[model samples]
Target: MAEQSSPDWMALARRGRRHRMIFLGTITVFLTLVSLPVVMPYLWLLTMSVTTLGSAAVMQVFWRAAGLVAVLYLALIVLPPLMPERFRTWVPAMAAAAAVILTTLFILPLTTLNNFRFLWNPDVMAAQQGRSSTIGELPSIWSAMGNSFALAGTQTALILITATPAAYALSRLAFRGRETLSRGILLLHAFPVMALTVAIFIQSYWMGLLNSILGVVLVLTTLELPFAILILKTFFDAVPWDIEMSAVTDGASRWQAFRLVVLPQVSGGLIAVGTFTFLRGWEEYVYVTTLLIDNSHMVMSLYLFWVSQDAMGADPNLIAATGVIYLLPVVALYVFAQKYLTQISFGGIKG
Candidate 1:
């Protein structure tokens, strides 16, 4: 048999495969390295809490913590690029896994202690520390949770209803000045939220919506409108008009077509947009502070702020713990909707 040489095409194929593998390996290493610095301190926080100290001691510990973080960040930047290709991918992954373990085991619980104390009123906290036997559960936090849920839910629904149609028009319609209008919508966020609150409060006062949760809802809805429209509009633009047109040819009305065809494709986007709107309003304090005057109408954000400011029998535990609890809805919402959010963005791309 005659000796055969490698063909040009086979040689090129091998070269291409090697390039891709190397590229992937490099990317994996870089991402892993970037994540290490963030994860490492969280680990340290968790670990250090095992040994104890005073207030001043804690302050010193935090300063030392900062210095350590700076060093770790520098190490990630300088050392990762210089690492061997084989080690690059696995090193970061291993580091990240270690960081995660540290965070779960040590950091979260210690950090949580601060916020947890804030939820317990003085008598209750004193009771917890064995200073007294009498105690009470966090009634205020429970009330605020209900209030936050109601307000966030209402605002989220309105955003879906109003923002969806408006966004659809902006993305799909060819109306005059649509581009300028879209830009203008986003421009509203440029002004300080406080400035906008001032203006909205003036209107609220004149209209007798001041001191009302309804008023707070109105202000948040307006503030949220820009983001809702902008995000959904982009998603709508990604959907092909061909689907709608096909439905129209079969005698489907525009509304019917949108209901049956367009919406199915954008369900993920809808969830994402709704999640964004809910989270924004859920965490918002500015408008709630300005527009609400009635204590009865106070949502959770304002309720928490009151806890922070109230002078009578204040315990850090009461505030911090409740604040953490107050954060649960946003966390839960994120957890439930994260997959939907990704899908929606993907749908937006295809739309």
Candidate 2:
């Protein structure tokens, strides 16, 4: 029998690349179609924020810009693999540049433009003032914003302080019922937050924590703890044991080793956990509304609710303005934490 020819490894590799490219293209198209319905409303919201240039004109402009962006985005996705081998290295940089430009032109403008009417247009301000008489005294926007920041900041700090040690132990220590305990913590997260409302209220009332920022912070911290611990634990698991062992050998106490050596390695996880905790606390509504009925302790979430009730006969633009303000801090935090957040891991072995 004739000897079989050796397989063409290069041809097989080329075929694999082609298959991957086709799969990625198909996925991109599918996602784009799925996202259109979700993204259109937000696009319209941004357009409405910017120009009284009328919906028809704004929409026409939006679609044209969107089409151009889609073309560029698709080119970035589809062109790289097809490019000559010598030029392929440039594709990623070009794609990143296009992404940044697209975001700068289309996405970033929305936040700034959301409050344009209130900021720049005198007539719109006058109209808003006229409607204010019909709407009862709205809560101080500044006060509510301050309250929100205070609550979220406090909750985030508490979570980081409490989660780090607990996560380290869970990840590294060999203890009885460790797996069971970890599962139990996660099970707590599955409970509907509303289900705990009555119990929390009673506890708060008895502990003299009712209707206070501290109370809200404590409640949110409790709600956030399980997930925070879980995330931090995964990050801890990713840390190499030998590094901490070396620190211990260098006359560092266990706590010192954890603090001086281990913590720095998992900084990304800490930031990721902190960002999620802060955003949750910032956006919390039901618990805040239930616990703090008065405007004195009202947060931005409650303030937005009050505005939406037509209590101030506020225009859609004004409500959108409040939303923009409310979202800014969260956006800023995410941007600051973006690098760390991307590096967070959940799949390292216990060390």
Q: Specify the poorest-scoring 10-residue window by lDDT in model 1.
A: 129-138
Candidate 1 per-residue C-alpha lDDT over 12-56 given as tens digits, one digit per residue, 9 for 90 to 100: 999997897688678767976888687655544433343233344
Q: Which structure among the candidates has the greatest TM-score?
A: 2
Displacement of the residue 321 alpha carbon in candidate 2, Å: 3.0
lDDT of 2 by residue, 1-351 (tens): 999999999999999989988887788779888888987766566555554443455565467557656666666665765677898787778766877787677655533364555444545544554566554444467778889999999999999999889999998999999999999999987778888999999999999999899998999898889989988888888888999999999999998999899998988788888888989999998899778866678898987776655545656656666666777887799889988777765664323
Spell out the clash pairs found in candidate 2: none
Q: What's model 1's lDDT at 80?
A: 69
**Candidate with maximal lDDT:** 2
Give stretches of model 2 more than 4 Å off.
8-10, 53-56, 75-136, 175-177, 343-346, 349-351
